[model samples]
Target: MPQNIVVSQPEDLTVAWAQRVVKLHEPHTLVTQVDLVSVEVGTTTRIRLAVTYHAETALPRRWFVKLPSLAWRARFITALPQLLETEIRFYQELAKAVPIALPVCLAAQSRWGLGSILVLADIEEHGALPGEPHDVLSAAQAGLVVDGLARFHARFWHQHGTVPRYRWLAGRVRQVEDHLGTVLAVPLMQQGLRRSGAAVPVGLHQAALHYARNRRRAMRFLSALPQTLVHHDCHPGNLFWQQHQAGLLDWQLVRIGEGVSDVAYFLATALEPEQRRLCETGLLARYAQQLHSHGITDVDSGQLNGRYRAHLVYAFEAMVVTLAVGDMMPTASNLELIRRTATAVEDLDAFAALPI
Candidate 1:
């Protein structure tokens, strides 16, 4: 068996490491040179590399790698739950079976005391355009994403009776994250709201703060519905656009939850208010229809609509909390997401829908 190799910094992407990774997957291939192409630092450090082989082979020359955040604050926030570790597990265990478009995982590994590392065949090299947080999707583009998510959710719809691997997705790590979010929610919401200023309407402030105060209860209410594997964080920046389909990325937040929550998060963060108003009703109907097509016939339209409205609260809170956790994303993009999700909450009366 190959030894555990965890990469903690840019300097650690050595040719020897590349050779080891290649050997694990393709025994005959020998990696000759590993050139650093670019580095993007945020919630995680994304490094792109151009590789050379000793002999001609069909393997990809360009690779996209994910390591833990280089920033201390982002690292601190993510380390407690081992977010990157969750992502590595997803790529290792679930990526192959799920019928969604995603980058091919080349190698994924994590060590106990050290961090995790993921190497993927660069989707850009495969002719896909990555979406950005600030990029608003058109109604047509939003439909594609919705359809893709429907298929993904249907695959694991109410899959609680499944194998142990799928069940491992929501264990100790997620519980720690939940506890941390609950303990810190009120303060974070307050800070985020203050930072938001006119971006968040004054009328919604009390409702948002109230939800924050009672977040634990609200979370239970949201999770009361049918459970399925959810992308959890379905923001535009974590998606990529191929010719006609949208691919999911950043599986750090994947978990078991209501499927419509993914739909709500995506529409809230990916669409502008005006566009969302025009597209949302149709997109939701389409999502339901797709689920039905996948033989998930038990979903009721009325209940799905209600759950969608109720779930918008989390979408709003997610953006606000992202703003609170400074340096996780670009400021302008974070604020814009806040504005969009706040609009979604107000427009849907999401706070009123919450059981809290």
Candidate 2:
């Protein structure tokens, strides 16, 4: 079961967080009901809250609120403008011309010492997780997701030299690799393998060391790719399908990176190994077709296959991530961390599974 990770608060709360949410969103009328406060994983304060509007309002909305941790907020005081600027830029790129559906950016706010909050339109639930572990997505739904990726990427194809501003977006992948290095990398690798009843194979540590040394090369390889607006973490957990539309959420890691990185990370982490094994080629072909529809006819099937290989550049990232988060492990999460590490390396050896 997923734990509702909540923290305690004193009754005399000085800051009016509740009022702040309403003001940030510009409520059509004052919010009358705010219940179902559920906490989510983050180094900072993140929650999903349901807000009911005025007495007659029927179309109530859910908003996902993400705020920095108290500690993070303190360090960000001096650098506040830069941090907010980067975030605004990302949202602008994703929102401007793309016809795809993302959580509408209801609000992005910075209240000085209180840090920043990004309030997003929540994708409503029909029900939580209707699909089977390997239940296939309907053809149309898959097409929308893959097409969305292609559209976002094709926007940047040849504009590399011309659009100087977008050049740095390519570096977002490096920022990701760096962030994961601290929170999810080495420690989880050491932990996940041993817990899965998988032996710590010989040369594991050496391989890890080598991977670290070549980390720059791996990052460079991604930076070398045609950068585009990538929804860096688009696993099934980050996606929700409702009738004819699909809602893509969780934009914290959104940045400019290789398009394949999103496809790879999403498919690898979201699908069962069996599902990925069966559908990898088929999905890639479809995504390529979508690219073609958008006039990106330069890439052939051979180059498409190459993106599959390049996805492995993020294998270590996925391993640590699976360990850091729950649900991947059967027993103790931290204990099983070692198992996830070994399994990630296993995929590195085998040519199966998405790089995610």
Candidate that would win on lDDT: 1
**Candidate 1 on 126-209: residue-level lDDT in tens?**
789998999999998999899999999999998855767787777899899999899999999999999998889999999999
lDDT of 2 by residue, 104-222 (tens): 66566544344455656665533323222222454456667777788767876666557776666546544654554544345554554343344345556556544544555555565
Candidate 1's TM-score: 0.97
Which candidate leads in TM-score? 1
Candidate 1 lDDT (Cα, 0 to 1): 0.91
- What are the TM-scores, per candidate, against the unseen true structure? 0.97, 0.71
Error of 1 at 41 (Å): 1.8
